[model samples]
Target: MLKESTELSMILVQNRQQQLNGNKRLFAWALVLLLFLGACSPKTRVLKSPDHRGGNVGGTIPKEEKPEGVDKEKTVEDARRAEAARNSVALILPFQLDKISPRTLLKEDVNRSAIALDFYQGFQLGLDELAQEGRSFSLNVVDSRDSEVRNQYVAKSEEISNAALIVGPVFPKEITSFGTHLSNKNVLQVNPLAATRAREFNLPNLVSLTPSIDVHTKAMAERVARDYKTGDVVIIYNTSDNDGRQFLNGFLSELRKVNSSAQVRSVSSVPQLNEEISLTGTNLIVAGTTDRFQLRSFVSNLEAKSSQEYYVFRVYGHPLWERIDFSIYERFGDFRPIITAESHLKTWTREAKEFKENYYSLYGVSPSDHSYKGYDAARYFGNLLAKYGDNYPEHITKEKFEGLFSAYMFDYNESWGFVNKAVSFKSYQGSSFQLN
Candidate 1:
């Protein structure tokens, strides 16, 4: 269904444009009437919530700037979008830069300091680019570790209320308090790491960079339908692990959204999948576990059976794909694994690659998806702060920005909560991952 959905988008957009033109003459007449009324009116007409765009209208360009090789007219249009893009990002306040004990996660390995610096390092890279482009940055590194005073919550609220974009305290409790508080402030509070199921909100300003359960699950299911449209889908999980449960929930959610009415199967242990696999004519499996031993065992069994059921056999999972030794991919031999990570290896920023290679060279082991995730989150939003700063709402709010970590599309739903604005799919097709 999504395959078709993606193809139909251009048709839909053109139909919308045709509808917009239908009322152009009427809009012109209305504008003339408005001008006539303005001449006779005692005060300028005022109505709240006027539509900002659309309709036949004329005015001076919204912004003006020099362009690379464009004439004056095109430069004006480019300037408007550039200004709008610059304004869309929000400014997240860090914990007080002067206050709080700077307690960093000490590196156990030799390259701890270098690896740890990555988050701030990537963020500064964005900041440096914006400054070179002649943009001003108004960033405040608040001491997030500050102890809260009860009455002072209001004062703290006032201090941050003006900030259109807020990054995070990166702790569950801090996220809860600030999330609840800022949900009302029209400011976005993005939590890079501390994604726990504390509560849900309808805040226009609040968006989670990570998919909680629903988005991940649904996407996994959609990919399943596409990859194995005729197959019986099985969800295998370890009952003990929380990640297993979270991923299983997501897999089932995705299955429900697919266009075809496919058979869905489930089981608790590896032994159960072995038996269930025999019964399901086609098996598309999701191994949802972060534990390496469990995942390895699961992979070994599934790979042994791949030749028997692979016409529609596919295996999928979460960011846990990062934790397991990737060299094991060749070990799996015939059976390929599909990991649902944020993005592909090549999708990393230039600094991201440098950090990864350098991190591996120093630490031996590579960084986990979560590590890059944190690096990307900090880098992305930190750059947002460094660029738009205070003027975030005017530009960032209206446009969807796709970046290294996640796609920052401000979409929300009343029932399911904020769908993770961005997610990329990659599959380990028995060897290296192939991005879809």
Candidate 2:
């Protein structure tokens, strides 16, 4: 990863040096980036703090330029637009082949063979697709070993001279570091994971690809208000993770928005399902965890009370929902529960399918949350490199792109969380997920 970053730095520096002879296009785009998104930070500062922000407020403003010919003006506008439409991104994951750790992910034959790399695989597919479209950008990738070492690596790896952006380092600590000290020069950190652990709420430069858990919770609450009107809403969660906090916050916020007087309850221990008394009136259960202890408890409790009148709503606080060992239909036993899945995956791309199939075939299993998420991160970053070309003189403007497993959009909020935010309902009909 260090070597790759260093190589990229050399290339970017060379480009700038070559362009100093008078490359107006590159200079113009640089001005746009430096002006709108605070891209003017010194290269050393950018490296130290990849999540740096507080600039680029002016990029959204329109600047009219009149050129010689009608054809020339149109060409200039198109070029600028193209630069704006595309930019580079980075995806830091656990894929450092040199250093291997069992705790790192995909270590076991089952997970390694299949699951842990799905997201990256899908992300790679997106890269190939972008190349086909003739848009290319450079992608900086690193593996955090899912540990503090990765944090140190990220903290110091900001030396990439002209990197446009970064997409990951899946852990929140890493994200927080980037946010707290965005030292990357002329580059932005596009966090695709680390959704729940965001301590810094709004950094203008860092962009989160996942929708805030708050968004999901609020959306679910709104839906219930629209459909159920008034009822019993229960939120089940693993109190251990901070991710639960966001979900609860969002859910509670929405409940008040829809009906300030709505009743709310939170439970951490699944075994305490017994504590949950009386299913009178409209009953709604929302579990904020994907823990086996909770899922099993939920399954047993729900099944035992299959005859009760209630609505089972499972809110996947994150991809943790996928780790569940229980089958939705069997656990609920004919009960139709609404499953909320948050993904940045584009879902319907040729490359996505290929990646999925290849992943399953290679590992003899389906891709795990870590794999698919990591893969998407990589592909998204790669797509940026493809679009910007080798010169990278043009500053990329924010625009939405259709990713393999989800749609990604970036705003100045600096939290990539929203880029992957889309809520879709999945009903388990005893066997498979049926979209309603």
* Candidate number achieving the greatest TM-score relative to the actual structure: 1
lDDT of 1 at 199: 41
Model 1 has an lDDT value of 0.48
**Number of clashes recorded per candidate:** 13, 75
Report the lDDT tens digits of candidate 1 across residue range 1-436.
Answer: 0111111123222333333232442332223222222222211111111113323335543446434333544454455435433333332322222221123312221132222223323343344334445443333323343233321352255545444455555545555555555535555666554445324544445556665555566667787777664545554554567777777765665566675477666787878877677444557677677877777777777766665655435567776565556565444534456766655446445855776664344323345554555555544554555455655445544556555455555455444234454566775654456665
Q: Lowest summed lDDT over 10 consecutive residues: which window, candidate 2?
A: 42-51
CA RMSD, predictions in order: 18.5, 14.5
lDDT of 1 at 188: 61
Please give each candidate's TM-score. Answer: 0.60, 0.56
**Tens digits of per-residue lDDT for model 2 on 278-351?**
35644456666554554565667667665464534433333345444346445553545555556544446677
For candidate 2, the clash count comes to 75
